[model samples]
Target: MGADELSATLWRGRRQLDFLLFLLETQLLHLRAGNWHRLNFTASELEKVLENLRFESLARGVEATALAKEWRAPDQFTLPALVEIAPPGVWAELLDEHRRALVSLVKDIDGAVAANISILEKGPDEARAGLDDIEILATQVNIERALAAVSEASLPFLRDFLGLS
Candidate 1:
């Protein structure tokens, strides 16, 4: 739970966020292209990443708490608080960088999700306009199942990130 360990966790979390953003972009492309199969796969991948992020978040909380206690900061200190109290050199700068990058990544993810939702709101007829009867049925089933699973698992994480709960 030292600064180095906390830094490593932050680094890993950033990479995970980057991968999540990539998946969101890919999911949006598949939605626009009407590639239901790939979209389903991406949805599953997103679930896995979200699960990993949940665990990573717990680990980060523990590490951050320990570091905060070591530094004599108040309870439930935020990354910004940590940055403010960090030794005035590489650690302070690095933590600030991580915080900024995470914020930007979260905003990008939010934008991508909004775009995907907009395309989805256009309805199945527009999305599946070119598909044959069988393809439409299969796509509908697969997309429904995949999106339901993702939405169920993703809502809490999104809510937490967006400070909704």
Candidate 2:
């Protein structure tokens, strides 16, 4: 990807991360309210948000991989590593140090999601068999998987961008 394309891709990925964070925060609120019905609906909505995140992450990954390949190969037109792609000060300006901040935020969200999953899984034996509860559990599992996917997709990008890995 060209510089502008790469910049756009990073921007889009960050926006998707923001949306995922919002959804998870909302889920936490519903959990705190002990509103199972609303929580169920929130889980359903989270499914949709997760789908969008996956799509965005996938596209971002493709672009980043393309750029990485270019960085590795000897082409007539060289592609720099992500950190070298922009001017010295441009990346720092554009991302505003938030990429590192996002690392922490994602970790916090993962912990919160896991805690909720534990609570859901530990409900009374009688409640476990209900299909609705099972569906909710399944959805929560999917959310966890999606979170992993987002991390897997974005980590390489962040690592290359921040030289963190």
Candidate 3:
């Protein structure tokens, strides 16, 4: 389901926690299928997505606290602003060789989505004329969709620490 269709049951503060945990479990299915997804949001969109989170009161740099490492208490930022900043050093993180492996995995998911859209828009007959590898295409599409859903329901590190959800 897209953002527009998300019900209050799914988005309410408490239920959202449980939903995120459920999402983490569901992601196991995608992992088994060798699928991973990357979330690429513009600064503004990222801000909007995290606006409701309780990160502000949370102490920064509390392990898994990327924001804390590079920032301080007096230096405040809105969710949108933090999205633009992308939690600490976005560029440095991308530059890491080890992290590149993770990037590649997520890139595969994004590529699958682009392929699916192309197939639908250009019509299956034309898109799959030569490389009509239906099985491979279908697998990628299914895995990609599952990963995207999990990405949307991602949880905070705090939840795990508090044993909340």
Q: Which has the greatest TM-score?
A: 1
lDDT by residue (39-111, candidate 3, tens digit) is: 1212223233334444422422232134423444124333223234433554333323222332343344344
lDDT of 2: 0.54
- Could you give the C-alpha RMSD of every candidate to the true structure, in order shown? 3.2, 6.0, 15.3
lDDT of each: 0.74, 0.54, 0.35
Clash-forming residue pairs, model 2: none
TM-score each candidate: 0.82, 0.60, 0.26
Give the per-residue Cα lDDT of candidate 3 at 35.
38
1-165: candidate 1 lDDT, tens digit per residue: 778888898889889878888887888888788666675687788878887888888888888888888888888477888888997679889887888887778777778777766665554676667778898787777676556534543435433432434
Give me the runs in candidate 1 sitting further than 4 Å from their true place. Answer: 127-138, 145-165
TM-score of candidate 1 versus the correct structure, residues matched by position: 0.82
Once superposed on the true structure, which residue ranges of model 3 sit more than 4 Å away at CA? 1-11, 29-132, 154-165
Which portions of model 2 show Cα errors greater than 4 Å? 73-81, 84-98, 124-165
Where does candidate 3 clash, by residue pair? 47-80, 61-68
lDDT of 2 by residue, 28-117 (tens): 665556544455466666667667766765676676567556555333221233444444666535544445555665565566666566
Worst 10 residues of 2 by lDDT: 73-82
